[model samples]
Target: MSGSESSAPAGQAAPEALSFTVHSMPQPSLADRRSRVLGGRLRLLLVLLACAAPVIASYFTYYVIRPDGRTNYGTLIQPSRGWPADLALQAIDGAAVAPAALRGQWLLVTVGDAACDASCEKHLYMQRQLREMLGRERDRVDRVWLITDGGTPAQALREAVEATGPVWMLRVDRAVLARWLAPADGQALGDHLYIVDPMGEWMMRMPADPTPQQVKRDLDRLLRASSSWDRAGRE
Candidate 1:
């Protein structure tokens, strides 16, 4: 005991020593933790949406609400159909091509028997010319020949068609293909050329006998609209 404190406390009580009781910080409640998690999830979703905005906007502009009105020549398949997962596709060499491989490139698909009659030949010629017509944008488009019958194409016709860029020559079931793509009334399955986006969904179909220039115009619009998101090669 100090002398001052003892002397001062003769009649008065001594002062208590200064002291503190430590308390722990309050913990977060279950509800508060849940809210924090939800907030983090929402922020992640917003980031994803921001990344995909350009692609969504382009498709919306081209398909959903076209400001330029309906000047498109190709028949738009409303609610576009996806590439049939079960649809068996094979290369000319008899190697099976997985349906997933078709993704990541815009496809100009033409269907016909391997025999390739007059109308089929005409379509093939037009297909090549149209891609070429794209000029600098030609590499962005691929020419695909989906042979409906099991038979292989003639060497001469194959040589003629594949003279420039390589053509995706594949064999598929006629009946299976018919179920996926339909022609106009009174027209056969081989009448039209189908337009498939890079994601492998059939979006448009050309006329039974389409004008080259008009077809090119529709392609131009589609390519330009998707330019921001799409690239020239497969993934």
Candidate 2:
């Protein structure tokens, strides 16, 4: 043994050569970069469609092809409309009502002056009957009477409206309302009962003096088709 080896500690051996592993850093080419981008986009698209599926399905069933294949009695509003952000709405007591408050339930809306004319009275009765006819599904719906002026409805009239179920009477500007709902050509806005979906979009407008039986058929189909959809109950 060499002199240095002999002088080393008893258990010590000569120094061994150090070894290292060399790895090539990943350098993605153009195709690899494109693939990654495409993958990310596809994932995003899938997520969006998943979130929108229920809404799309419900709307399609009502607007496009009904399962029973029967045409709707009410006129479908194409590219449905929502309450205008600037629309000034107030409760019966004149408290400000946020537009967001109107969302999250089916709204059967009626528009008229607070004087309770015959046409207005008939519509109020029809609204109640339509809701009652829904049976258990009645709980999923609500009635909104938009009074276009500052006048309060007669006590008897309000009582009649609430005799069966509560009606939301809000004072709204008639001009502002024109931006959210409209009537058939040559007809007044109060002449039609408007159907607003849970998302607050105006979806349907009843014919002038709509028949309860025909309207009931539409409501039945709507409630049936949307059985899967739900929201927080009656806020």
Candidate 3:
């Protein structure tokens, strides 16, 4: 009931400043801040590395421990070139063929006379057999027979090529064909099996008469090597 006693005077009501000592917050030096940031970044990097290790390890195991003794029947050409920009082609039906159409599949190409010489028959057989041996992956590889010299193949020769399996008997000009498929120093265009990759690049040239077994080995290794990225289909 005593307002004067309950309510202190304005001068007395003003609370005095507390006598507590002000302690400054400890400031981190630039080096300390950098160290913490570095530690956090290292931890994040370690997490990412852990996620990537299995895939990287799988590649390492396959490449390093799998005993890479596989060999190719084709002469392994170093630095093989892509299909020349100026290269021209003609299909068996005399229709103009574009080199760009060869992309998206492995091409096992052979050049030979339309007259079907003994050597040409052998190459054709090997090409068929090598492709057949690929099993499920056979469709991924195609056989392209470039009958050079512009000579029209006999009906029997065309029948024989068709009978072998899926073989393309394209009639290509010898001059243009030769420009695309350059033989070795002592070889001729019709003397070897030329390999063109999925990217339309002529990558390898096999011996004139490669054995079926030799060609098979080369294909197996190539398929295995490219399995991570390549698939069955045209470009």
Clashing pairs in 2: none
Error of 3 at 94 (Å): 1.7
**By TM-score, highest first, what's the ranking?**
2, 1, 3
lDDT of 2 by residue, 1-235 (tens): 5686446577877677799999999999999999999999999999999988888898788777876677889998888998888898899898999878877788899999999799999999999999998888898888999999999999989999999978889999999999999999999999999999888899899999999999988887877777776543655
Point out where model 2 deviates above 4 Å: 1-13, 17-41, 231-235
lDDT of each: 0.89, 0.88, 0.76
Better of 1 and 2 by lDDT: 1
TM-score of 1: 0.85
CA displacement after TM-score superposition, residue 1 of candidate 2 (Å): 15
In the range 107-129, model 1's lDDT, one tens digit per residue, is 99898989999999999999999
lDDT per residue, candidate 3, 1-235, as tens digits? 6576657677776556679888999999999999999999999999999876754554454445555554345666556578667777787777888887878888989888788788888888788888878999988888998877778888786777777465767777677666668887787788888888787778688776677788787778767766665678785
Name the better of 1 and 3 by TM-score.
1
